[model samples]
Each structure stands twice: as structure tokens, then as C-alpha cells.
Target: MNNRDQKGFNANDNSNFNIGKVVQNFASPETRNNSETKLLNAVKNEVALRLAQSLHRRVYVELDKTEDPSQVASPWSMDVKLGDSPSQECPEGTHIVTIFDKKEIGGRLLILGAPGSGKTTLLLQLAEELVQRAEANAKAPVPVLLNLSAWKTQYSDIRSWMVVDLKQKYGVRKDIAEDWIETERILPLLDGLDELMSQRQETCVQALNDFLPDWTGTPLVVCSRFEEYQVYESNLGLNGSVIVQPLTDEQIETYLCRAKCDWLWEAICPDRDIMNPETGLARSPLFLSMLVLASDKLPPELWRQDKSAKERRRILFEAYINARLSCPYRGGENYQVGSKKSDRRQSKRKPVRNPYPKDERTKRWLGWFAARSVEDAQTELFIEKLQPYFLKTRPQEFVYGLVYGLVLGLVLGLVLGLVYGLVVGLFVGLVGEKSSNTVETIKISWRSTPRNFYKGIQTYIVYGLVIGLVYGLVIGLVVGLVIGLVIGLVIGLVVGLVLGLIGEEIDTKISDNQGIYQSVTNSIICGIVFIPFGVLILTALHYFHEPMQLSEILAQGAVKGFLLGASAGGLLSAIEHSALRITLWLFGYAPWNYSKFLRYCTDRGFLQRVGGGYRFVHALLRDHFAEHYDPS
Candidate 1:
């Protein structure tokens, strides 16, 4: 086939090449390459819209078979309105002409929607109906629905994919004939084709043409992002489309009343909270399902929680994740409105993975898959995403950071304090020395004079302290205490922290950590070294005209510093203690663990990790928070 014939999708050619008995044998590089190029060019637009329109006809239902014990839904008679949310068939517009009939849809249908559109829920509901109908029929054949992402080849023939996927979905021991299955017109729905990562549009289209054909006309539905379809649809040559639109509150209300699920929204009730008289389900089908599931699973009496209107909406949304986890929680409930209890659930073989590997030549070939994953460990999950987070892990290194920072500040503070103290002290001493008649001790001994008594005492104290400095004890013990505490308290204060960071910056220029450490030492060392300044100040005061004794002034300083230092230490100590306690309590896990996670945060949270302690506590204490920590 030349480019012109290849221009349109060719399902026959691809079928001949891929036809083989062993599933493993058919999985080859050549076939994969050929298939991807064809699929990339396969028909788009109307194909997606048409499918979406078809699938939209089914009634929405619960994903889980068992009730999520934590959820609180509305009363049985209460008709919870879907309020503004999209429904199956009618998105935002009035009814239009039918493009296809039930006969065309048969037991299978597909609908492709944009990310925000309600494709998945609509598809699931349809799948449920098809499964039910097939089960009810004695002559019914197997009908399977699979996500296209599970497929390995980007350009894969849909028919071959069907046989293989059905084998996996049904645990078929023997391979089924592709022609035989097609002749009977059995259709298996596949969703999310835009999610496939192959760059070769031509190959993907060819794969589809060879795989899906008009002869059988089995309904195949797929959703594509609008942008993706525009770029890749030339080769497929297909049309008929439906676009999902935003729904009004009235629409949501109408759907919800019709849905008659375990949820309802109105002004208020004992079971459901008073939703914004205006707020309704709208925008997407996914969101509608989230609200229904959360409302149904959570206890009805509790659905009207203390959350802000926005917060309640967010809480309502957390059910999607519950829906996602429904796979593991299957029990004995039927989500389909008309489903019979006697109709047993089918468990398929292990799920299949259809990987579409990218080759290096195309611009998006090799790494495109990574780009599309959209969410992962580092990916931030918002309320919309339905992923939970544990907050306790955040402050894990708090103590290590705070203490290491403080110790360094102490050494630097000491050095700076010495220089500033010595310089200031000496200047005061020199100024006082200039004022004094002689530098030694400012006192004039007078015989029989009351004033002389004070002078004599002042001189004695100054002289005594000088001698103490020269000897073993510098300044009297009182002098030392006075100066030390004052210096210690100030050094430990917030000013020290600012200075330390500044010191670090200067260190960057000079690469001098010793200088940084020296400054920290000085902040604390200032208290010790500056004690002398305190004594000198007392001595200088004595030289002045109305001087007090040097000893009295020194005593005052020592007392203040000691008291201040003790208070400061206690504060810093408390900070450290609180940090550790909170870090353990809130983040990942610690003494308390996250015991309340499944219980406290159940429907209201998308908690991935433990609620971090402080943030978690804040959330708990927030006005709407209903529970308190027991710590029992």
C-alpha cells in the first residue's frame, strides 16, 4: 500500500500481519511499529463525541460493592440533586437527533472525553449494563471493557487487542479466533486512547483499520484530549462527535433526583448539610460520581459537616479515591440500578499491560510516557486529585537545624562581644581617666568629714576589684555575675540569630567558617569577656562627681544577667521540646502513630501520609473540625 491508500486507516492489512495463535508470538517489534503508526492516524473527533454520547445514556452507579463505613449519605427518600453536574447523553444542551440506535450499540459502546469531562463514570455505568444484559441472556457472549493504557503497542489493531484483552479479562484458557469473534459481532469497549504515547500517528491508524472494521460494526468508543485529536486525526478519516459541556445547578438537581442514589443536596437536613442553595453538580461526570459515592458511603447523618461550602465540596470529592480503591473492596452489592443480586460478579485473570514504547527517532518517542504520567511522588496532589498526604514528615529535621544553628551563634557572639566590650570599655575608662585628677583611684581621704566616708568606701571597692582582676579572681564574684548574665541574655536573644546568618554570608565570600564560629563564640563569650566592662563602668562611676561605689554597680549587672540567661535557656529548651513532640505527632509517624487517620479524616481527607502534627492539629481545631485528639 502506497501513501495514498495508507492515508486512510487499513484494518485488513494489519490483521493479516498480526494474526497468530500464541499471544506472546504476536508481541513483536515489527508489528508494534506498524501498529503504532496506523493508530496515530486513526479517526478521531466524532468518534470520541459519538461514543461519549452513547455511553452518556447509562445511569451512573457506585464503584464499591461494600459501603465505606465512614461516609454519611442522605436519607433513602431524599432525592439528592446532581445539581449542575453532567449526566449521561445530555451534557448542557437540549435533546438532539440520535446518531445511532440500540441495535448499533448492541452489548458494547465507547465514549471518549477530555480529562475534565465525565468519560470514565459514563463508560463504567454502560459497562455495568452491558455486563448485566450479557449475563441475563443464556446465549450471551463475554463483553469486556479495558483502558487503552494497559496496551503495549501504540499502534495496535483494536480487534486483535480485543481477543487478547478478553482472554485476560475472562481468564480464557485457549485463544479465541479473531475472525470468529468478529463474525459474531462481539464488542469490547476500550477507553482513553489519547493516553497512549506513540508518536507515529500513521502506524496507529493503520493498526486500527486492520483491527476494527465495518463488517462487524462492533461499537468501539475511545476518549481523546481535544488537542491530541486535532494533531493526529488525518489518517483515521472518521467522524460523528459529542462534546461535554458544563451543566447548570438545575441539571445537577434533576439528575441527582433521577439517580436516587444514597445522596441528596438541598437547603439542609438531619442527614445532609445545607449545601449552598445555589451549588449543584456540574462540569464533569467524574465529580458527580465522587459526590454520590461520598454521600452514599459516609453516614447520612454526618454528610452535612462543619466545613466551609468549599471544604464540604472538597470532602465530597475525596470519595473518588474511595471509588478508585473499590477494586479491592468488592463485596455483595450491585452498582447498576437494575442489576440483580443473583447476577454474580466476574473476576478476570491478572490484568494486562499494553505498553506503547517510544522509539528515539520521533520527537516524543522515547520520553513521552513520562510526560503524560502527570502525577507521582513529587507531583503535588490538590483536593481535585484525590491523593492523601501525611504531614508529620515535614519537621523531621527541626531539632538538628535549630540547635546546630544556636551553638554556632554562641561561639561567634563571644568573639564580637569581646571586641565591642573591650573597645567600649577602654573608651569609657579613658574618658573617665581624663576626668579624674589621677588615674589610680578617684578618692580624697578627709579627716572628720562625712562626705569623705563615701569617697573612702568607693576607693576601697575600686582598689579591691582591681587587685582581684590582677590576682586569681577578676572582679568580685558579684561583679562577674552581674556582667555575665547581662551579656549571656543579650547574646542568646533574637539579635544573635540575625548576626549569625550575616556571618555565614561573609563566610561565603572569604570561605571562612572559623570566622563564623568565632562570632558565635563571641555572642556567648561577650557575657564572659564583657564582665570586665561592667566592673570598669562601676569604677568610672566612682570617678564621677556623684559616683556610686564600683561594687554596687557590678552587683546589679551580675544579677540581671543570671536571671536573664536562665529565662532565655528555658525558652530555647521549650522550643526544642515542642519541635520534637510536634514533629513526631504530626508527620509520617511517631509515638501516637496515625491512629485516627482511617477514622478521623476518613471522608473529609485525602490524607496520603500522616497528617503532620501542627498542620493536622490546626485542621482539627479549625472551626469546622468535629473531633478532638483523645491521646488516650
Candidate 2:
């Protein structure tokens, strides 16, 4: 090759032309793209699997083909529309995904259906399809399924909320989720718009409209009940919409026959004038599933009996709960056991014995929990949310809490006090047995350091125990007084462990003040710090159990934490030398003289001297004394 042709790595040149460098430069973007694509697919598959497992587990009874509207009969498809008004019908019969494909405008789809119309199932099925498509086409947007019921009225824009929801619900990294959302690389499949407050539905629709820019072409899907969505007159600006068709009588009969539920078929058959309001519910997939489940126990006469739709649904719910509770636990099927962990499938465990042994008792608790859920407008039940409900049911919640607190304080205090007293007695006996030649310093050492350190720990333990016991007792009494003992014990143990390990010492140091003032200052500091710490600890605990609204947490946490902090401060102040002397002198707050009190406590092994000052042998005694002094 000529020199001129070789310029800038000429085409024919092999020598001095770096193949490795060229390859590296050429392959960098391709390799990165491939890696990122694989990561995205993994995330999609993981999310899809988790969502699918949860759905299947929740709907444990197999939904046979006979029960499906599409398979057994013509799948009920809704009219396609742009916005709220009906548009020209281009397709004769189609499912949700086909509408997305054939739509002229953007792929924003709103699904309208009745309560048991299988809208959720359709959305999940569509999401699965999109997820599969995304795997093949790297540029295809990933499908993210979200429960609209869990979407609180926080975000003004749906896009912003989608980012957060993906991170929280699907375990997607915040950064990756944000990148996908901002880049329009995700198709949000939102289910349960009907779960929100009626007033909030229009607001959500408006938020969706506001979220999409004029130039943006990102697709989104929403599911809502027909009645609920119709309440809002405003159109949800979408390219396509459809309603899930209700199950027909033939479909219901076919399912019943296939499941060997002959009695149930007779109850809702055409011969019984099944079109009437009483027997009309047979058309709903949910009610049919319930019937199929309860057919063994529920007599056909029960279904034929005249009753309101609401009454029938209540009966069905009761029967459903009864059947599930009575059945043997199969891993994750037990509702009462295990937390809703981040990884749903991995977290499943063997069934736990329910506290309520009888099915009736379990059903009653379930009813109570359901009532509480309705009151709170919660779609999912958590044990933590029921804590407040338990208190509300008890007319004497406060009285019970106070009485329990006092009882626990006294019992725990007496036991701890006696144990420390015995130790003090032994130490005194030992010291008396020693020779007089022994230095006073060794005697002080024996009395002060070990004793005070031991007492500090005791105080923390007692306070935590007392607090935990009182809280748990109050909750347990409201739930079931019989279970209060177990609840209190567990709570007390957790609190004690947490407090004893993390408890801070009252710093007996103050500028130019060596004893009482220093201790008083330390108490104040401890109280202040405990406020946030208490909130953090309690919030974490509650989040894992029965989750509550943030507002409720803050209000309740602040009040309780403040009272706790003040109690601790006053209790800590009692141990300081000058403070004790002044309080006793000024108001006769304590019965004994300051010096005599010190000697009495020291002799009892309840306190130990540190330089010119004294501290309790255990923080428990100190806290008890403080609590007694400041009863309020």
C-alpha cells in the first residue's frame, strides 16, 4: 500500500494497524448493551415470577377452562373508546392486548369491569405477554405490574409514583427504575383503580393525563370496576379501553359439573329462574369460585334460599374463610403465618398453629379484621394495623394500659429489687469478714463500681420490660385477653434485649459541676435523643408487622416518646447527689435524709460511690425510683 493510502490507518494496511484497539472500540457499546439487556430481562422475569406466584397462591383453586369466559364462550369484550366517549369500532371481537396493538393512538388502555370480572387476571396475563415480548425485542419497553390499591394519594403525577412503586413493590433498584421511567422504557400495568376512594379516582385519572407529555409515546394500562370508573364523568385520556365480560350461566354450570358440584348447579340452574336478583350472582367468577370451594359443605338449599346479594356475599365470605382456616396448612397458604417478605416465594414456610383453634373463632377474628380493613380503607390486612383496632374495641383501653403498666412495674421491680438486695447482703458479709487493715478505697471499689454498673443495666432492662409489657398487654387485651400473657412476654423480651444492649449511660459530667448537675444534664440529653430513637425503632417494628399510616405513627410516637423521655429524665435526676439533697430539703420529696438514703442504698447494695458521688447498682432501680417519684 502507498504511504498516502496508509494515512489514518488505510484500508489495506495490516502492520502498525491495531486490531485489538479497533475491536475494543467497536465492541464496547455492543457489550454494554448486551449486559444491560440481560440485566433488564432478569429483572422482568423475577418480577413476573413473583407476581404470578402471589396471584396463583392467593387464588389457590384452579380456574379451569370451563370457568373462563373466553374458552367456554365468546370472551366478553368491551367497546373500544378514545377518552370517555365511544369511538368507531374497528375490531369485532378482541382481548386487551390486541386493542393495544391495533390502536391508532398511544397504547394507553383503560379496562372497565365489574367486581368479579377477572380484570386483574387479564392485566396480569397481558403483562406476561409484554414481558415475553420485551425479552425478544431489546428495545421493547418492560412491563411493570402495580396494584393501584396500594398507591396512596401521594404523587401528583403517575410517572413519579410509578418509579417509586417499581422500586418498593418489585425490588427494582431506585436508580435503575428511575432511569427506565425517565427514558420511557417501561409500560406500567396498573390494577385496581376502584380500590381508591371514589373522590380520588378522578384525581388519579387527571394525574395520568398530566404525567404524559404531548411528545411522549409511552404506553400505560389501567383497570377499574365499571361502576366505580363511571362515577367520574371526566375521561381518562387513553387510546383504547375495554370491560371484562361477566361469566355466563353456561360457564358457571360447566365449571360446577366439571368440579363435581352437582348440588350447586341445581341451586342456580335455569329451572330455578336464575336471572332473578337472588340467583344472578352465579354469573360472577368470584362467587362461582366460592361456591365451588364450599360445595362440599354448603348445601344447595342454602344458595336457593331467598336473600339479598349483600347477604349472599357475606355468607360466601364467611364460608370461604371457614373452609380455608379449617383446611390443613400447605406452606404459604396459611394467612396468619409469616410476613410479606420482599421475596414472596423464598419467604414461604410450613404452617403455624393458629391461636384460635376452632374454625368459628378464627372466622370471628377474620370478620373483625375485615371490618377494620374496611374502616381504614386498606386493601391488604397487616397485623400491625389491627393493633389500634384492638385498642378501640376496648372501652377501657387507657385504664387497662395504666393498670397493666403499674402491675408489671411493681412485679418486675420487686423481683429485681430482692435479687439486688441479696447480692448487697452477700457483699456486706464478705466485707465484714475482711481485716480492718484493708484500705477504704477497696471497700468503695466493691460498693461503687461493680454495683453501679450492674444497677445501670438492671434499670435499662426494667424500663424496657415494663414499657414493652404494658404496650403488648394493652394490645393483647383488646385482641384477646387470653393471649395477652404470651404477647407481653414476647414484647418484653424484645424490648429488654434492644434496650439493654443500646441503652446509653447518664453522663455524670457537667462544666464545673461534678455530681448532681452533671447527672441532671445527662438525663435531659438522654431524653432528647430517645425521641427520634424511639420513633425509628417503633416504626421499623411496626413496618414489619401491621403497617400504619405515617401520620398515625408520628402522632402516637411523639406523644408516647415524649412521656417516656420525661419519665427517664426525672428518674435519672433522683440519683444525682445535689439534686436529691435539694429536692428532699426543699419539698421533703423523699422521706429519708439525703445522707441516710445514700447509706441505706449502699448498705442494700443498690448503689455504689464514684469519687464524691453515687450511682445505682442497676439502672432498673434508678428508673423505678424515678418512675415512682414522677408518677405522671
Candidate 3:
């Protein structure tokens, strides 16, 4: 067959890949086109920024043909064209992009490497190039970097999961995300397959295999640790596989020299123990980079110590943490230590200060976070997603729930009454016991005509009636039954109508500061909407109920309405999350302001921001912290 046939498509051909054509026939073509352009630009910007953060200086690692592609790739000829082979061998130390372009591989590539061998870095490098290409050519597929570790068994289909990832990670609307997938405009670069549990790894491999048939012409790339991937019974259905090569001694020396780390190079070059094959510390780019960062703080004699690879790694990480913490801070003032105004005459640059919580406390908090993240099998940590499970002991959990419920109840009671407070408290306490495993972004938008307006009214009216009935029973025991029933019906109808008019739509998307702001705004709106209704109800009730003054009734009604409204909205959830966070802080597991702490860690090079969450700079670092975690 000709090269064009073998490769599945000509490099110059744009007919099959034109994204504009894909959405041209859809309704509101202009809107779709704009959304698509925005999505691609956002992806490019995010990928470029991530690449810059992970690798401060661009360092290309070499990739080579796997010794046995047949071992990891599907053997079934029907799944992939195994018979068709490349006319010439891919030379040693070939760039990943070049290998991806070859006819035989046809864009379906799998990358494998040993731990700390730069598998993720290589994948990001590939994504950077692909994103550039996509930006230049609309016909080219948009490259999206995702973590397979986040995949769950619930999503039996891989495409469905990708849709969710795009929506959550990139903030793409659900319909648009689905359209992008259906049109095959996305080039998925899935990383961290080995990060999944062993059993799930096999299942993910099978899922990828099943997903390939439907996505026959589209490109796909997956990364994993060679040792873990090789043991899996199932093989990925891909055109080809390549393993990331370890850094040669010469390459290591060149990198160190370029980094101006002559002392590190000198220490590593002469030491047989440090560069030994078993330890292979200098051979891995990640370790070498860590060594460079930690070199100044790391004592010279520590490198020559006789130690196992694991112990050596532990010591290296300790030094690395110290070095990062000790270094001058970089990035924007997202989490500044103090509010010091910058002088216009002093170059408008605030002087750098030491990071908060000190080095020892920072390490302990990170260790705790890493341990819990591993236990949950989570690669990304979201501030709002912190659960009761983060609390180590049962007593802690109980205290968190009780405090959370009690706080809400007391606030509501002070404003509304004892009955309202007790009911809200009981409800909130029950909800606190339930786990918050799902993370999502809720949006409240107004529609000209809500989809189920009548249904919503009916549902909310029922809720209002139930609450009103309880209030009526409580009031009736003290006051007359007629007065209680009349007041209850009016209050219930007004509250129900108000709620029914404002319909809320919850969308599952990733959010950070923006999400919190949105929730706060929602709470405020809910409080405002209920205040007037409350004032009118209380003013009318004063005639037949207790003989109260007009000003006193209005004051009491307004306060009660606002509190009840806020609590009924998202105020309860916000308070509950705070309770959980404070509980963790009391146990010294995390700081009070998690977002700031995480941002500080990102500034310190221990973590990197991914979408609305944070992930360790490398899985190896996460593993190190998890293994060495000391709760006490």
C-alpha cells in the first residue's frame, strides 16, 4: 500500500478534519463556531502555561521504539494493522512528534517509561506541539491533556468520560463538549494510566480497546509506567508504542552545565554510587531536576552515603522540599503573606517574604494531604471537594458534623425562631453525615420560560407546606389554632411562589475561586428575595396573632427571612465546608485557608495547578510524601 493509505490520511488533506465544516450544518452555526474557537484557544493557553510551569526551561527527552511493541500493543490484526510495518526503523533518540508522524503509527501511540523517567513530560511536550498545530490549522484536532487516574468504572464508555472531563476541566458547556467529541475534533492525550488501581488499569485498557473501534480515524495517545503496563493482561489497541529513554551520563552532564550546576555535576560525575544502574538517580530527568533544585541545601557527604534507592530518594525529597521553601518566591501575588503596599518609586515590586506555617508544618500538611489523596486514588485535589473522610478519627468527624449543624441551627434560630432553627439543624446534620464524593459547579441562570416551572412550583409548595405545618403545630399549642393555620398558609404559599419563580440549574463543571464567589452571590440573592415576603407575612400575622407593634414585627420578620433564605440556599453548604476545613486544621492536617496553602505549595514547586484543582508536580513526589507521612 502507498504511504497515504498506510498512514490513514495524507498530511496535507484538510477535508476530513475541518472543524468549521463539522459545525456548519448545526443550528446556530455562528454560536458553535465561536464556542469551538474559544475552547481551542483556552486549551492552548492552559497547555502552554502548564508546560511552562512544569519545565521552567524546555528540556527535550529522547524516545525510542519499545523493545517489544507486540507485548504492550494489541496482537489482534483486526484491531490494528499489525502486518503493515514502517519501511525504515525509527532511529534511536527520536523525538516523540516525529515518531507520531510516521505512516505505520498513524497517530495512535502509547508512551511507556520507568518511574521518574519523564513520561508525563514527554506527553506534555507532544501536546504542546499538537496544540500549536491545531491553532494554526482548524482542520487539525485540538489536543486535550487528561489524567486516566481520574477515570471511574461508572463511565463504561471512554467518550462519555472525555466529555465530562472537557466540561469540568475546560469549562466547556455540556452540549458543546458532546458535539466536539461526536465530531472527533479532540485529540485526547491521556496520562497516568498506572496511577489507577491495578484491577482498574486492566479494565481501562479494555475500555480503551473497545473505544478505539468507534474512534477509528481519530488520533489518541496514552502514557503509563512501563513496569505496571507490562504486567497488565490486556493490551491497548494502538498502532504503535514507544518507551521514553533514560538520560545518558553525557546528557546529564550537559543539562547540569546548562543549568549552571557545576557543583552538582562534579558531585554526581565522580560518584559511582550515585550514578549506579540500580539507583539510576542521575539517569532520570525528574530526579536530576530535583537534585539541581536541592543541590545547594543538600550536603555533599549525603550524596556519597551508602543507601538503598528508596532511602536515597527519601533524603533527596527532604532536601528538595527545604530548597524549594528556602528559594525566593515566583509567580503573581495570589497568596501573599502580608498586605504590604508596593511603592511606585520602588519598581512596583513587593519584597519577597518567608512562606507561612514554616518549613516543618508545611511538610506535615502536605504529607497528610498526599496520604489522603492516595487513599482516595485521586490525582487532583479540589478545595471544595474536601470531605469528612479527611478527618483521621471518628471523634473528629463527629465534632465536625455536630459543629457544622449546630452553627447553622443557632444562626437560624436567632433570626427565625427555635422551631425553624431545630429543623434546619437536624436536616443539615443528616446531610453532613453523607459523603461529598462528587464535585461540581452549580450555576443559577434565568430562563424566559423554565422547562418544568409548574412542576417546580408544585414541589416547592409541598416543601413549604410541610415546613409551615410543623410551625403551625408548634404555634397552635401556645396560640389559637385559627391564627396559626391562617399565618402558616399565607407564609407557605408566598415562600413557595418565590422559590418556584427562581429556578436553579446545576451544572457539573470544575470551579475554584469563581465557584465560591458564585455560591456566595447565590446565597445573597436568596436572602434578599425572601426578606420582603417575610416582612409582609409577619405584618399581616400581627393583626390576629399576638398584639405586636408594627416596627417590631417588621424587624423580626426581615431578620428571620434573610437568615432562613440564605440557609435554604447555598449558605448551609458553605458553612458545612468551612466546618470540615476547620476540623482538619484543628487536627493539624491542613491549614485554615486551603486554597491559599495550595497556591503557596504551587509557588514552592511541590504542586502545580490543574484546572480548578492542584496536583503534585510529579506522581513520584506524591508517592514519596504518602509513604513517609507521619500523622503525629
Candidate 4:
């Protein structure tokens, strides 16, 4: 064949190959649509399950004793008006879910209400309905409830925050959350716009506006307090808005009667004067719930007494808290909200914790915790994060720490001195002798600074106290204390001294501008080299003293020493870096356990458990505690 024909034939073959590759990778319109539908359905099911669980989790069976069993779970509803005539979608009073689901409403609605006026309850109800609809319709968007109190507008936009919220609250995979968000397959039922800082509220609203148009293809709803949202001169420009109406006196009377709380109904509205403004306190669902629970305990005439509304309300709430605390309550009920009659009422999960033991200690801890929550502007409080609030933050407190550390060390040294002192002293003597004779000075690194050495001492003391306490509890206090003290002192002194000696300035020739990773590697190597040798030396010295197999002694001692060294070394490295030290101090290794107390508060009505954390059942309750609590 001619050269030109051969070249043309080769080019043609390459072109055909490229086209075939494109065809293989490309998806047809139907295929893309089907794939999208499947992903949406999976998300819908996951969301439905979560919403149902959250909705039914808090069934006050005991509290419901006064009410009809059938109506226990029924949330109260009111007719809601949305916007003015022409552009108005939901002119007739409509529910939250209906406004969000109706195509004509375009799924963009704002719910504004007073504190504890049932905004959250309404949102939850909306979520429950959407969840059910999602199950029935494959094309429906999954509704996800998001708490906006944690949103930081300066750092992240609304869309980004939603992604994080999903992953955190629901344990949704980040990729899946992002995909769901990007595809607009998930509906965001945002709660607590008023929860954001007042100053940043405008910026948050603006960010919401910017984020909504292109990102979420489906409709979304936002909730805020009526007065808080009114602070701004302009509206949020949402499709429609509804103001949560105050409960009518008749409604309150009827509700109380239905709940079989005739006593409270008469107390608040004597002579069946339901419209009397004197019973204005019942307008809030929170206050009404409190009255329902506390009516039996409170004087029937307390509501009619000369006490001001504020004082009466305070007394009612205090009584309510006490009632919940005293009751033999279990956790919330967990049943599918929109299932068949037979299966709908099925209880799935038990209360998160057992009924709280009624006690003063629990109340005190909850009061302190509530105060901290208000200060931090955090509604959700995780148990692990509770340590920081209990931490002694005043700079003057370290003086106490130092004295405490010294006493601890001295006590530990005396106890452990019986066994480890001689061995450790002997090892130190040998090390000291070897160094004195050799030209090789003991090298120092950042991990061995005097400050860190002091810190290590403190850490060891705490560890010893914890171990000693545990042991003391398990065995007799005196014996357990002695044993734990010895173990803690031995580990702490051995590890602390080693780290302190090594933490000083090293010769320039040895450093080689070592980076953190390299330093860590070197520290690990040092631990691997020295720990076993030290352990072996100690074991040999004690071999005749303690009747044990030498090999077994060496093996166990070596393993323990190596672990101690590695832990000390890593801690030393963290201490050397300022940022890392602060981070560790603040988060990873803070020193208190308020878990038991937190659990107690959560089991009762004072707090609500949410994923790995606790939140005050309502913000108003938190404020009440914060203002009224005087722990001093």
C-alpha cells in the first residue's frame, strides 16, 4: 500500500476507538434519571426512619396519665395565616407541612412564633408528614430538620452547614449528604433562626437568601421567633410567612378538659370564663404543659393568687421540674409515626437512660450545665464537651494545682517507694554514673521542658487519683488507694522524669532541623530502645525479691514500660507545640466526667437527648434555670 493510504487508515482507526470510548462511558437520559431516583429513595427511607424515631421518642406516659391515652401523642394545631391576599398561597389557616408540600406554595415558607409557642413542635410535625409522603412517593424530597443555632455565618454558608449537620446528627456519610444536597433531593426544615446571635441575624438571613436559589432545587422552610425576626426592617423575601397564634382561652380550657386536668382548667379559668385575660399564661404550650404536670402538686388557688404572672410562672416551672424529677419516668417512646395501625404504636427504642434518681446533686449539676449552655449560646450539650465547663479556668487556680501536684507526688512516691523506688533509684544511679563518665551529655528536646515536666507531674497525679479511686471503690478504700497510688506514682514519676530530662535544649549538630514527624519517629525509636532495657533492669533487680518467672516478669514489665514511654513521648511532643498543647488541653484531655449527672438530667424532662449530646428541652427552661439557680 502507498504511504499516504497507510497514514490515513491509522488516523481513521484511532478516531473510531475514541468514539467507542465516549459511547461506553456516556449514560442515556433514562439511565441517569433512574439512578437519580434510586439515590433519592434511599435518602428518603433513611430520613423517614430518623424523623419517626425522633418524633415518638419522648412519650410522657406518666404525664399522659391525666389525659386520654388515645390523644397522648396528638400535637395541638392552630389555623395559620400566610401573607396578604394576592401572592398569598395558604390564605386559609394551614399546617406547616401542608405549606411546605403544596406545589402552589412552592415549598418556601417562614414560620414565626413566640418562644415555646410550638414552633419546633410544628416543624417536627411537618417533618413527620414529609417523611410519610416521601415513603409514599418515590419522587418526593426527603425532609431533614436542621438546628440553626450552631450555624456560623462567617465561616460557612447555609448549604455547607446543612452538609455538616446531616453528617453529625444522622451519621449520614459526608459524600452522600453532599450529593443529596447538590441534587436538591433533601428538603431542609431549618429551625431556630432566632437562635443565631442577634447581630448576625441579618447576615444569616442574607446568606440564606443567597444559598437558596441555585443550591436547593426543592422548597425549604425556615422558622424564627416573631419579635426576633421583626427586628430587621425588611422581610426574608420567602414565598409566604405565618405567625403562630397565641392559644385562645377556649382552646386552653378545652385542651385541659380533654387531658382530664379539670383542676387546672378551673384554677386558670374559674366559672368557665375561658376568654379571661387573667389566664393569659396558658397561651404558651410550654406553660400549659408545666401546669398539667404540676397542678396536682401546686395549690389549686396558686394560679388565682395575687402573685404576678412572672412569679406564678416561675413557681409552676419549678414545680414541673420537681415533678419530672420525682416521677418514675422512662425515656421517650419510639414508634413509626405514619405506619399501619397495628405497627404504628409499636415501641422500638427504650428511654436513653434509666429514670433519674431524684436528688439535689443532679439538680445542682443541671443548673450549672444550663448556665454554661446559656453562656456559650449552645442549645445542644454533648457529654464529652461538658468537662470544659467544669474545668478551673482562672489563672490563679494553677497555684492550687502546683501544691496539689507536689502533695500527690510525695504521697505516691512514698507508697510506690516500697517496690519501684529501689529499682528506679538504682537505674537512675547507673544512668547518672554512665553519663558522668562519658563525654556524651544527656540530650534534651522540646518534650522535656520544665513546664511540661510539671504538667506531666499533674497528669500523673490525676491518673493516680482516678486509678486509686477506682481501686478503692472496687476493693477496700485503704488497700485500693495504696495500690493505685503506687501504680500511678511509678508510671508517672518514671515517665515524667524521663520526659523532663529529655525535654531540654539539644546540641545543634543532633537536631538537623528535625520536623514534627521526624521528632515523633525519633521519640518512638528512643522509647523502643530504652523502655525494654529499663524494664529488664528493674525486673532483674526485683527477681530475687518477688517470686515470679523471670521471663514472664521481663515480658510484662517490658510491655508496660514501652507503652508508658510511647505515651509520655507523644504527650511531650504535643506539649512542645503551643497550638497542639492548647488544642489537647481544651478538647482531647480535659479532666472531668459529668456523664452520670448529664444522663440523670436527660432522663427527666429537664433535658432532651440528641445524638451523643443533650439539650435543654426548651431554651426558656434553660434561661429560667440560669436566672434562678444560685449554686453558691
Top candidate (TM-score)? 3
Q: List clash counts for every candidate, in order.
A: 107, 13, 0, 4
Off by over 4 Å in 3: 1-38, 55-95, 133-141, 171-176, 270-273, 276-279, 300-305, 328-351, 415-512, 535-557, 630-632
lDDT of 4: 0.53
**Which lDDT tens digits does candidate 4 get at residues 499-593?**
44443221211111123334455457556755664465346445423456767666656655654454345423322232222322343231133
Residues forming the 10-long window of minimal summed lDDT in candidate 3: 71-80
Q: Which residue runs of candidate 2 sit more than 4 Å off their true CA positions? A: 1-95, 151-154, 171-177, 271-279, 299-301, 328-356, 364-632
For model 1, give the 10-residue run with minimal summed lDDT.
503-512
Candidate 3 lDDT over 20-70, as tens digits, reads 443442323223255567666666665654655563321211011122212
Task: State how far residue 250 of model 3 sits from its true place (Å).
Answer: 2.4
RMSD of each: 28.3, 24.8, 8.2, 18.2
Native-to-model Cα distance after best TM-score fit, residue 191 in candidate 2, in Å = 1.6
Q: What tens-digit string does per-residue lDDT give for candidate 1 at 243-350?
A: 444444555565555555534545222322333323333334434534554554444433545656555545543343333333332221111112223212222223
lDDT ranking of the models? 3, 4, 2, 1
Candidate 1 accuracy as TM-score: 0.32
The positional error of residue 345 in candidate 4, measured at the CA in angstroms, is 14
Candidate 1 local Cα displacement, residue 458, angstroms: 99
Which window of 10 residues has the lowest lDDT sum in candidate 2?
Answer: 435-444
**What's model 4's lDDT at 68?**
36
